[model samples]
Target: MAIFVHLTSAANAARIRRAGLRADSWARTGERGVYCFPVLPSFTVTHQWLRELARRGTRGGGMVAVHLRLDDDEPVLVGHYAGRGKHAARSATAAEAVHRIRELDDPRGWEVFVPRAVTAGEVRRVRAVPQGVGWRYFPGAHGTRPCTCFGCRVRGEYGGRRLRERLPHPLDGPDPKVPVLLERLAAAGEPGDPKEVAEVLYWFARRRRGPVEALIRLTEHPDARIREDLVWAVGGWRSPGVGELLERLAGDPVAEVREAAAQARSDG
Candidate 1:
């Protein structure tokens, strides 16, 4: 089988391990739904993508980029981006692929694999910086100090912590509070940020066994906006019941909700 590597944050890597790739609303134009770059043909491309991520950091903090192995036959949407090579051989064996990746570039980013279920050894602790902060502020940066940029100053003025500590971990299994969280999710107001709901659902889909169930139940929520958010969140999940739910939601009274469900179904 052909080998493919997906580069993502360590937390998202944990999510991928549990439930596979799911394209959430934050995804861009060609990647609006369930999508992933099915190949990382070379380390040069991998480093490029990681540097891009570091350049455009997330709201949470600095992130540890992870490389995950996926086989060609794995069920996923094979999306393309600038980093993917059009002419690269897709039939390369795992060892051959790894060799190609290593030969392509000298490693730079925080690109390491723990390959274990939890923290231990060199995986016990990982260093991370905030959105604007970088290796320059870390201990080994040739004695450079923090940047004097406005973004950095604002971040620090608010008592923001710079270094982030990441635990190397796989997704944790079901918890009792998941159901309660689902209930609160179902009862959430319609006018607030749907992205927040989508984010919560993404995490729940990663760690909980029955988030799909909660989501399915939320489809019956009183507000059309809530229903729309649920449908958008469901697009990220790979499940048997999801197709059925989308089918039902396709006929929803609200045009927006119906359109969201139609797009979600079409994405799969």
Candidate 2:
């Protein structure tokens, strides 16, 4: 199975920065749909950002990038959420692989597949900005993007308030399995406790849809996990409210929570 991933231009730079990339380091997407941001973005809870792609070049299609450092750890999925089996290994010293990446012919643009789970933590290191956003942005068919690019071009039907509204939730049309899971968790759940809420949200992240909006509306979910999960879900929905919601989540106590919060605001 293969997984698809979409990330904004800003995230691509952040991913490299987070990985401790040096001034000379290079970052690019691989064949799979995974993105290899080294730093991940930073944002304000009150002002979540957006995932903006650059203008189209000659190449246009879903792509991925791999940082094949030789002296990292072992093999890992670059885009876990997409379920795409493509992967990259940095089992050798980082110096070795980084050298190889630079020598690739016409590496500027092509169809390259990478690992499954790509996050900032996975990068080795970078000291300065890499040419990520300038050269890379998640592409869609032709010059369109999976986000508003395609939606606006095709005049597609909006998903409606259910995808954006903060209240009542889209209980009628959300995936059926999620509702069942929510019920099971709710039956055994204790409200007001962030732990319970966090646990429930994690389960929801695995599904396509659930009572994610309801969880976001509740002010009681202080657990960064709960907060991140809610924001992530909302962003996945691509509700216009996504930027605002993610901005609110950036203040989470945990860096992981904050990173996830920043992720939700990407240019999608």
Candidate 3:
């Protein structure tokens, strides 16, 4: 079975599992509510989708469908009728779905299909989609649709905070649970998936606060990507000793690491 992801609300995720994707009552006459886009599976893609989900103003938490199956390559579309109408679309790709929607006299009636729920093991923290393993938003259709749904309207709408500022700093407060996150860092040396390890490093590093030895050690990690991310984290801290660390990393053997250090210095 081909697995896909459908990014939506925690509530909507449950609703879809109970009932298959259907037309939104808010949709105009004869319009189907299901939308789907094909996405290449990768860490960057999954990360981007989670970022988009957070931006859409999902306040507390976000949800993603880990396993989804569609009819062949086409996105499943539902119309006012049982499942037959000009509004229903079956394009081989998200881009084609957009093209099909454009051809319609009016495309407002259509909605995207919400995927069925998987076990809780498949779900993850809104901002913390286990590194290389998470759901991806197929950009083909998402790129074209205005998506007035609560999810779309709030995309990239984090008020004053930037999208990257999801986690709290280690020094944020006594009650912010800093020690728990710190323990995650301490446990990084344990054997595990590289992708997952990279994510943990990123989670702490992105906060850019409270320099720790474990984070510095990660800079020497075999994976250039992890090293690059650590450099970014170090650069973000902008503490008294960070400048020296970045200066050393400025000459890192890996071009990516050196480049990342350079960018971080410039940004800092």
Candidate 4:
């Protein structure tokens, strides 16, 4: 058997004890699964997801660690939590997943995905765990400059609004100066510095109104990063031809630019 721990709300403890764990959550690949971490020798590492999960608002009572015993041959998927799309998860048996994680030098952001529900018989015990044992937002995010984008800080999270105000994202901001922004946009054709273009688009995204005609001209900018920023900026614009511009960007050669265009259209 392989030992794994599923961290969840204490409020669900009674039900989990009675009925077992349901595969109620969607994995990165959009597959439904029950996520858990292997029971490593290091207590902190085994429970490292606690703080991040709590920050995601898994509310009820306090948090608890539900230990589970799975047969070595039970099917599962395992991968780094940061991977996206369908290919991120690797197929493995329950035992293989545990062994792979154990071999890693650092398994802080790794997770196991059990595709089927866990029966009550497989649950070993539910115990209280220290709430502050893990990383918040993401692993190694402590010293790095945080991305205050709407997708990152979001709107309603505690202290999110204040943080956005203090250290605004280039694309999501504390507003921008119209004159300075226009000057930069006008000069975009001169040297076409990608950073300057991104900054101009950021201001345009926040301002939502300006010399949109000049902004439209940059749609063909050679730099994909600028084009991505342009797609994001146009989301807030009420100007003419914005929809057409987005449609063109939706097929951008760069995947990130295309994704941004899709998101901008969806948000708009």
Candidate 5:
């Protein structure tokens, strides 16, 4: 038998003790499985996922490590957590997966996926582990510049909003460059790229000051998308004529433009 450990919330310890661990789909690929780490020689390496898993677990719940004993030839899938996908995990026996990971110089992100549920008989014990033992955001993520993109730092995550504000991405940052935005607006004429025009308008919506006259000219642009974007952008401005522009857009022929105008007006 090969020893492995699955870390989960301490709150679920009683249910897990009674019923074992159920296979669940938590990956983007939607593969349902129990994630575990091989019981390697290094104590810290064996329980590396504790901190990250706890961060994603219930806000106040502590964590426990459940040990399992599986047959050496039991089927499993293994790979780095970062490469988890529909086809990225490699098929292997339980023992083979442990052997491959042991050979690695650093197996911080490695994981094993048992496609089926684990039986109560397979569980050896569930013990409390130090909640603060493992890495936080990711392995080796410390001292490195973090990505502030929506995908990297999603809304509502702990400290995500503040982190994005502190280290904002150039394009998606809160502060907008007025001169470049005006240039983009000026060049986005009748034959301009609708996507580019919309992007410029998005930046305008983040700004407190800009050329209101330049934006007013685009209110008559043929593309309803540009007009809709213009409505949203003008909603952020305190300059003269912004209210009138929103009122005009609220009566626009396109339903989407009119809706955007109404929503922006409500938001302002």
Candidate 6:
């Protein structure tokens, strides 16, 4: 009945640990029960706090099971096994950051689950709601079944590139479709909001891929959407000789396109 709202202090961690909390599980482990911490609106928000703790030299030796909720009181989802930061994490360490991100980015971190597969009927699901709708549905995963949402099925896109990334199977590694899907999303199904296509395309541009010089040439496509798509698309590739083109896209008029270019700068 007594829930610990603030694990912001070592005192709290120690107190929780004393209450038979298990490290890495929601339930008790060998009489060491796991203490559950819930964050409404965003269950994953705990990662931010926990990650900060790790950054500040506090490693969570005890496994903390994160429980997501709609409000501070309403329960949603519960998942287990988050890690404390390794003692050797650094800004320059890419692999460390990747591991940290992977652990923190646990899709199960949230209560409400959304599938990335946007069927024709689920268009509204992907619409730009005020962050809450998406947050309420913690990890949006599309099971093995096909999505029947309108927007998702509109152009054969489930939702954002994330849907494909978060599906239930084989998600621990980099998205396998990064290369081929980038090409297809470049030519994403037409007849919908060019903005949506641009969204998915921009996602491709942000993720992994190969070559940029050739793709930069495609940025010349007449359609503004395609142009916007290619502008960001270039950054996802690692080809040399296209830094200037990337620089130019960095200031593109479109907000998302410009955003993608800014992200590309850090990609290198």
Task: Identify the candidate with maximal TM-score.
Answer: 4
Error of 4 at 227 (Å): 29
Taking the tens digit of each residue's C-alpha lDDT, what string does model 6 give over 1-268?
Answer: 2122222223234433334222322221222112223333454453323432222232334223322112232222233333234422122222222233345545343212111111222111111111122221123333445333322222222253455545523423443365665455456543434565566565555444555553565444445566666655565455675577778777777775665566566444
TM-score of each: 0.32, 0.36, 0.35, 0.62, 0.59, 0.29
Cα lDDT tens digits for candidate 1, 1-268 = 4333333455554445455544343232223332112235443444344434444333334454333444333333222222246422243334444444455433323222212222122122232323332233322434654443323322222322242112212332333366676665656655434655665665454331344654676676666877887776567566668888888899999988987887778546
Model 5 ranges off by over 4 Å = 26-30, 84-88, 154-156, 171-268
Worst-scoring 10-residue span by lDDT in model 4: 203-212
Better of 1 and 5 by TM-score: 5
Candidate 2: which stretches are off by over 4 Å?
A: 1-95, 98-199, 206-213, 218-220
TM-score of 4: 0.62
Candidate 5 positional error at 104, Å: 0.9
Better of 1 and 6 by TM-score: 1
Task: Candidate 3: list runs displaced more than 4 Å.
Answer: 1-176, 190-193
Worst 10 residues of 6 by lDDT: 122-131
lDDT digits (tens) for residues 32-83 of candidate 3: 2433322343444423345444443442255454444543444443332223
**What's the CA error at residue 58 for candidate 5, in Å?**
2.5
Overall lDDT per candidate, in order of appearance: 0.46, 0.39, 0.48, 0.82, 0.79, 0.39
Which predicted model would earn the best lDDT?
4
Please give the RMSD to the true structure for each candidate, in Å.
Answer: 14.3, 13.4, 18.5, 9.3, 11.8, 19.0
What's the ranking of the predictions by TM-score, best on top? 4, 5, 2, 3, 1, 6
Preferred candidate (lDDT higher): 1 or 3: 3
In candidate 5, which residue pairs get closer than 3 Å at backbone N, Cα or C atoms, i.e. clash? none
Task: For candidate 2, write residues 1-268 as lDDT tens digits.
Answer: 1211233334345554455322221123322223332211221110111122333211223222333232243332222122233323332222333333335442222222234434454443322222233332322233543333222321123342332333333332343366665675566555446665555655555443344445555423645556666765555553345455566667766776666665555434
